[model samples]
Target chain A: MRGKDVRLEDVVMRFGSFTAVQQTNLTINAGEFFSILGPSGCGKTTILRMVSGFIDPSEGRVLIGGEQMNGIGPAKRPTALIFQNLALFPLMSNWENVAFGLEARGVAKAKRRDRAYELMALVGLQGHEEKTPNELSGGQKQRVAIARALAVEPAVLLLDEPLSALDLKLRQYMRAELKEIQRKTGVTFIFITHDQGEALTMSDRIAVMKAGVVEQVDTVDNLYAHPRTPFVATFVGENNVLEGKISHIQDGFAIVETQQGAIRGINQDKATIGDKAMVFVRPERTKLLNGAALDNTFEVDFERRDLEGAFVNLFFKSDTGSIIVHEANLGQHKELEGRAKIGFNASDAIVMRSGELSDE
Target chain B: MNSLIRSYGKGLTGIFVTLTAFWLLLLIILPQAFMLDQSLWSIDKDDQLGMKIDRAYSDLGLLEYDAQQATGDTNPAVQEKIDTLKEEIATLEAQETDPPREYGLQNYTRMSSLHFSIFVKSIFYALAVTVLAFAVCYPVAFTIAKLATPQRAALLMLGLIIPYAINELLRVYAWLMILDYQGVINSLLAWMGVVSFADKTWIPFLEYPGSVFVALIYAYVLFMIFPIYNTVETLDKNQLEAAQDLGGSVFLTHWRVVLPHAKPGIAVGCIMTFMLSVGSYSVPQIMTRGKSGDWFSQLIYRQFFETQNWNVGAAYAFSLVLVCLAFILIMMKVFKVGIRDISK
Candidate 1:
């Protein structure tokens, strides 16, 4: 079955007096794997529920396949949802669980059972049609949930952190598996997750949300390389933030004066001179100076070092705040200690107008 | 036993074991055993024993008078007759005081056709009450368990339980007041010009067996609802949404998901309701007020109190116990739930 586009036009959701989602317009193209990435309680799940027809937006309309979805319930809509806990009916056999949608539609038992078997096989779960959900492992239950959602031939499939319950390895594995299934089925998948890594790994485009507002929506690479907001820059990945005023502005870069000294970075937000700004640089991009000249440099006393498997995080402390410099874990830096100079090129850093930074 | 000792030490363990054993024997086993023994025997009452004793006393008095009137040689003969008569009176008195007991199953076998019909009717009525109670209580239980907000659910539960704080007989009497000839419903009907109090043209609700059924269901509604509420409360809300998301209607969702999950509770509720209604004496007695025929429990009561025959009462009571046991087994089978699940 082919996928269809989903569009939320000026949609807003409010519960009682509390607004869960701000007014927003978004268009998800057909057959694209889109992800809404945010921290917990950021209204991403609210959006998923609205799209799945569980809750109607308090304002505006939700459209699927160019048809208005106002006042339509989840069952009548062309979307299916996979809950976070993978709510598989424990009393039913695996095949029966997969065929529940067909049964609801009044399909004959034998035909539905055959279709269930086919769908189960599609998820690589053959020869286990009669096994109950409790008899299977966690991942198998996950597959059964997916097959159940697919049985309805929905144009859009909405998943709300379905991998959050698995262990790290299984979660990483399921990311690729989900991506592959989305590719083969060519269904518009709207995945909601708080894990930026999962979104980056699986999504064609990612929408970063914060406090009931959509911060930015772009491709995975663009969202990471050129985040429009300070929240997105720090939330999408780790960043070293320096708050200061824009002292100078050039063609496309700005110099910010801070307690750590003057630092120049790309002015993505186009901050004017004398405006408050924050400079953000990835830890991996910052390097040990070792007398090499760079556009921006600072001297800091080494505070601590953490050894990761493939990378080493060297934490340095200035009078202002701590700055982490990430490097590959080579044997050269095994004996390094004390004060050191670290630097990064101006093009590697970004400058935006001062705004809220992520607390975590 | 070992675990008890390990948990509570030897002294408390001994007390616990002894108390449990005492409860088992005194509260459960001994009473049943006594009923069984009583049911097994009937007294052989000879209706002529009192007359025979009176006759023997009169004969002794006459023989005494004859002895007093006879001469020396004739007096000895008369004295011997008097002695024999006295002995006969003593034997007749003893027989009158303590009759012979015939041990057999005659009490069970000698049930009259009318009483047996009442027994069957009682069973059938109890079954109906069970089904109707389930139909009424299942939706209420599910709403309270899964639909209502927490405070509203608590309020609903409190409302259900508040009536039970009063005595059961009082509650049944309250139903009597509501359904009596000139009671609440009929009075309201009379005021509405549907029926007239002056002409005595009021509906007789107590005359129908349904009145007793309604009272029985109202009396034991909690027995049916609480178990189901408990089971349904534990169901995850996500499962419901998942079914709806899969296009399952409300009926299908409950039929396939909620009902299956609540099998044990439903079985328990049916068993409790059936047993309570079948053995209910006061509810039918109060609700019907002698307008309808006697229930099996009322028949058993009459056999003991009015008929003054404990043996037949025990037999009828034991029969009811057997029927309840069979019903429990049937419910367990139909619901596909084990005893362990019910206890939970």
Candidate 2:
């Protein structure tokens, strides 16, 4: 089946008196794996529901393939949804569950059964046609749900955190499996999840949401390397934030005056002088200095070190806040830990106007 | 037993077991056994025995008079005759007092064609009531379980249960008032000038069998609704959305998803409704007020009280029980649900 682009123009959603999604404009390209990443109650699911035609936007228009989708119901739309719990029909056999959409369209039993088997084979479930959903493992059930949604030949597939129920290993495996299926089918997949890693791994582009507003939408690499907002920088990945004011501005660089000292970073938001700003540096970008010069440097007392298989995280107490320095576990800093110096390059850190940070 | 003892201590466990056994024996088993025994036998009473006893008494009185009037030798012969008559009277009185019971299946086989037709009609009417009740209740149950808000669902449930607080006979009587010859509907029609009481022309709702069905359905509606509501309430709402998202229509969604999940509840509802409607005496009795033909339960009532034939009544009642049991089995088969599921 060919995929179709989905576009939401000035969409707003409200339930009674509470706004679920603020006025938003988004366009997901055809055959692209796009993910809306946010925490619980961030209204990412609301956006999926609107695109799937489960709910009409209270204010704006939702269009699929350049056709207006107002007043359309889910059944009449060219979209399918995979719920978080899988929601497979427990009483129906796996084949029957996968073929239910065909049955609803009045297809004959034998034809639908063959189609169900074909789709199940596509999802790597060859010998599980007659077994019920309860008889299958969690990952098997996940594949069945995907196969069921694909059987309808929907132009767009909406998934609502379908992997949150699986264990970590299975979740990671399913991420790749889902990405592979999206490629094979060439269906526009709008995946909703709170796990940034899942989005970073599986999505071609990610939209990070907070409350009812979309904070930033960009490619995974750009989102991690140059987050436009403090919330995005903090929510999308681990960041060592230093609250300060824009002390100096130069060509594509700004110096922020903090309680500890002045630090320079890339002027991503282009804050004017004397305006409040925050410097965000990634843990991996921050390094332990050994009498070497860097754009931003600080003296810190080592608190502890945590070994994480391949990498070691060295925590240090600075005058302003705690800073973490990540290094490969080569067993070099085992004995010398009382005092240390940490620094990062000006190009490695980003400076943006001060805003809300994600508590998590 | 060991678990019970461990949980409640031996003394309370003994009491619990004894109470359960007592309930099983006295409330469930003993009555059924007695009914079966009563249905198996009929008392055989000779029609001529009473006349013969009267004749013997009169003849004995004459013999006594003759003995009193005769001389000594004739008196002895007359006394002998009187003694023989007295012995015969004693045997007749003994036979009259304790009639012999003849055990057989005659009580069951002796049902007339008219009564048998009523029995079959009652079964069919009960089946119709069951189907109609299901049609009426399934939507309401689904609305309460899935569609409505929690407070609204609770309010709707309370509305459904409020009528049950009154006695069942009173509920049937309420229907009777609404469907009588000059009842509420006719009165409304009369107000609309459809019919006039002055001309003695009005709809005879009680004359038709529909009135009884209406009453029976109204009386046993909860039996069908509550079970279905309980099962449908447990269904996850996400399953419904999934079906809809997969391009399932309203009919196909319910047919393939909601209905299968509610099979056990539907089976239980059907069983209770069918049994209650089939054996319902008060509904037809009060609704028809004898203006229409009788139900099987009414016939059973006649056999016991009016005909004074307990054996035949027991047989008829047992036949209804057997029919209901068959209906339960059929429902279980049709719904593909087991007894364990129904209990849930």
Candidate 3:
């Protein structure tokens, strides 16, 4: 099946008095694996539902393949959805579950059976045609759900946290599997997930949402390196947030004066002098400098170190707040305790106007 | 037994076991066994036994009179005649005290063609009521279970159960009033100029079998709704949306997903509705009130109370039980559910 681009133009969703998704504009290109990443209740699933034709947007429009989709039920839409729980027909055999869409399309029983087996084999479930969904393992059931959705030849597939139920290892495995399937089918996949790791691993582009608003949408690398908002900076990955006000702005950089000291960072949001702002720096970007002159530096009391297999999370107490520095496990920096000197470059630190931070 | 003792101690376990056994013997096993035994046996009462007993009483009186008339004479012939009459009276009394019981299927086989037809008709009508009740209840059950908001579902449940607060017979009688010759529907029709009670031309709804069906369905509709509702309520809502998203029509979704998941509930509902309707006496008795033909339950009642033939009544009642048991089995098979599933 060929993929089709899905576009949402000035779409807004409201439930009674509560706004689920505020005015949003998005375009997911054909054959692209796009993910909407957010915390729970951020309206990512609401956006997915609107695109899948389960519900119409309260304002503006949703278009698929440049055709307006208004008043079309899910069954009549050129999209399919894989629910968070997989939602495989438990009483039906694996093949029957996969073939349900074909059956609905009035295909003959024999033809549906063949097509079901073919799709099952595509999902690597060739020998499990007659077993019911309960007889299969969690990952196998997930594949069956995917195969079932694909059987309809939908131009776009919407997945709502389909991997949230699987164990970590299985979840990681399914991420690659899903990416492979998307590539093979060339169907535009809009995956909604609260897990940033899953989105970073599987998505070609990710949209980070917060409080019914799209905070940032970009490639995973750009999202991590140049997050446009403090929420995105903290939500996508761990960051050391230093509260401060802009001391001055010059040369595409803002100098923020905090309780500890004045720190310089790239002015990502172009803050003016005396404006309330925060500087965000990735933990890995901080280095154990021995009083060396850098754009930003601080003296901190070493608290403890947490060894995470390939990396060590070193936390320190600064005059202002607790700071974390991520160090690669290179058989060094093991005797850190009591006191230390840390520093980072201006470009590695991002300064933005103060806004909502993610939940700690 | 060991687990019970381990869990509750010997004293409580002993009490529990004893009470359970007592209940089984007294309330369940003994009554059924006795009814079955009564159904299998009938007493062979000689038609002339009453006549012979009367004649023997008169003969004894005459013999006594003769013996008294003999007076002071020691007549051996009179004494011998009195002794012979006394002996004959003793034997007749013994015969009256105990009539021989013959055990066979005669009680069941002796049902007349008309009664047999009534039995068959009752089963078929009950089946029809069950089917119609299912058709009516499934939508209501689904709406309450899946479609309605929680408050709306609660309101609908209250509406369904409020009528049952009254006695079952009272509810049937209420239907009787609603469908009577000059009852609510007829009065409305009269107002609409379809018929007039003033001209003695009201519709005879009570005479039609449909009246019995309506009452029976109303009485047992909950049996069908609750079970199906319970099962449908447990079905994950996501499955429905998933089916829809996969391009399945509403009919296809229910046929493939919802119906299969509700098999056990549907089977249980059908069994309960069929059993209740097939043996329903009040619904037909009150609705028809002798204006229409009797149900099999009514015939069984007639055999016992009207004809004073307990054996035949037991036989007919047992037949109904067997038919219901057969229906339960058939429903289980048709729904592809087992006894364990049905109990759920």
Candidate 4:
């Protein structure tokens, strides 16, 4: 396709001896909203800056629209950066700000003014041209900054934590607004943030970064349902680990030895004997069924139960370990606190090698 | 009452203002009254009579009586001399009756003829100096406020303050050494073959009151530059970038964005520069050797000290003060902000 596709091949960035973003490789298809998600100081913004041409990759190269960005400066590159603070010019009228790029290109003033009006209307800011940046509310200013960046019509729009400054309510509201804008513009959006929920909610694909390296890059569903690494499992969504070693294997099940007992799990990989492994079970996937049939059950006393809007986070304080059992909508089960027995079926568990994830 | 004192202790503004007025009246007004009284009286530089003496001479009538009595002793020559002495005595005795009633509008009118012109000239000089200083200082001020690094910024600031701290005469004289025909600049030029050692090379430097403008402006330019610089410094750098990003060229950006922001400082600088330059006689005197460069101050100085006319001098000084006041008033109206705002 002629549309822009981003490719980062073996990219490494370092500050002094501290390597931030090391030998990372990822390719994003055109029109996909890819998010680089991590905790603070995980080198997510650094990667975004490199893609936007604000920063040069210390090693390797970045390709957009199948062209190598060797000598392209930020202005010349077909990329626009939205700063964390939004970086809206405070002194200009909203209309003038959007028309800035066209003015630079020696377009007639009337034509540029009209273009600004059109973009403002598209971003739901039609009647607010005469107002300065400070006069507009935070969300409005954000939309204006977006309009100004889009005025150039760049191939890839780089967002560096644009929603981090907003309050939680506003942040949630802008998430939908940003998605709508992305769809309307039809531009490749490369968003960088530290919020996992935000990434999962809006991104077509999510790349989890840790200590400057991309741990995994995949669709959010794949990341949530089947995490290849424990870091991804822990970061993408909450998944509990039951430490064990493969005791025996069967046709569709494997028994893993642990302090609780030899637990049965669906053997997805058919792990070898005496191979140290972990049984990864989602909190919701666990059933505390007292009256149903179960292949495996743990004789554990209950620690506590937390009731959220639609589910409960059940903490099981056991000698093996404190494992969380998330029960979705515990209706008519108010007496199951203080101490209880929990049971689950073999189909609910997936076993893995103990060292499948690095200590990072 | 104790609580009242406690509450109003820091709120002593009204009391402080009253005290200030008392001091101002006691010191400023009383001294000004004495000066005004002195300005009315003419001083005798010739010292024909004692300073306190107001009585006319009696020898004036005695000379005439002697001349009439001397038929044998006094010859035609003695008579002629006596007649001359009598005329002088009568003139002095007649002055005693009127007591040199040269008061009121006469002194104020005398200012109109000679010293008044100097007042007008001083105001003009000050205005020219303000305009000239603005042209020379704006670029330097802009550079210091916008571009200089912290250390270099300090140095640029020192560049302004160092020259200002020097006595204005010395500051002006410093320029004289550089601009003079045989001084440092000419000597350097002579080595460069631009002009010979024997050639009078300061011909261009004298063109259009160059020495006067240079010395006067250079001596006081910091006064103008700092005020403008102060205003421009806090100006948001983002504003300039925004203007450019909004399609303004360099000149348009300065006009539409930067100049309006710096208006208050410009007004303050203009007022201060104009006030100082018009009243300054030393810089122009030293730089131009007090000859061809005689501005209005020279005339006022001559009127008060040389010609012994205090009335005309006061009138001239007053007129110049009034002119500056009028200009400041006009400026305040144009800027539409209080003086205190710009001063800060």
Evaluating just chain A, the predictions reach TM-scores of 0.98, 0.98, 0.98, 0.90
**Cα DockQ of the candidate 3 complex:** 0.86
Shift in Å, residue B252, candidate 3: 1.4
Q: What fraction of native interface contacts does model 2 preserve?
A: 0.87
**Cα deviation of A267, candidate 3, in Å:** 1.2
Off by over 4 Å in 2: B46-59, B66-88
Report the error of model 4 at residue B156, Å: 6.4
Q: What shift in Å separates residue A127 of candidate 2 from its native position after superposition?
A: 0.8
Query: In candidate 1, which residue ranges exceed 4 Å CA deviation?
Result: B47-98
Q: Please give the RMSD of candidate 2 to the true structure.
A: 1.8
Compose the digit string of candidate 3's lDDT tens values, residues A187-237: 999999998889998999999999899988899889988999989999988
Model 2, span A1-360: residue lDDT tens:
999999999999999999999999999999999999999999999999898888899999999999999899999999999999999999999999999999988899999999999999999999999999999999999999999999999999999999999999999999999999999999999999999999999999999999999999999999998889999999998999998999899999999999768999999887899999999999999989987788898888999989999999999998878998888999878875787888999999999999999988
Q: Scored by CA lDDT, what does every candidate get?
A: 0.93, 0.93, 0.91, 0.76
Better of 3 and 4 by lDDT: 3
The better-scoring model by DockQ among 3 and 4 is 3
Q: What share of the true interface contacts does each candidate keep?
A: 0.87, 0.87, 0.96, 0.11
Rank by DockQ, descending?
Answer: 1, 3, 2, 4
List of clashing residue pairs for candidate 3: none
Q: How should the candidates be ordered by lDDT, best one leading?
A: 1, 2, 3, 4
Instruction: State the lDDT of candidate 1 residue by residue for B1-344, as single tens digits.
Output: 89988889999999988999999999999999999999988877778888888888888888888877888789888888888888888877777787778899987888999998999999999999999999999999999999999999999999999999999999999999999889999999998999988898999999998888889999999999999999999999999999999999999999999999999999999999999999998998888878778899999999899978898899999999989999999999999999999999
lDDT of 4 by residue, A1-360 (tens): 123789998899998899988898889888889999887888998898788776688899899988998556666677777777765655568888788767766788899899999999988997899899889988898889888878878788888898988888988998999899888778899999888889999999999988787888999898888776656766776766777889899887888997778888877666788988788778877767678877777777777777897987888876767778887774746777665666677877777667544333
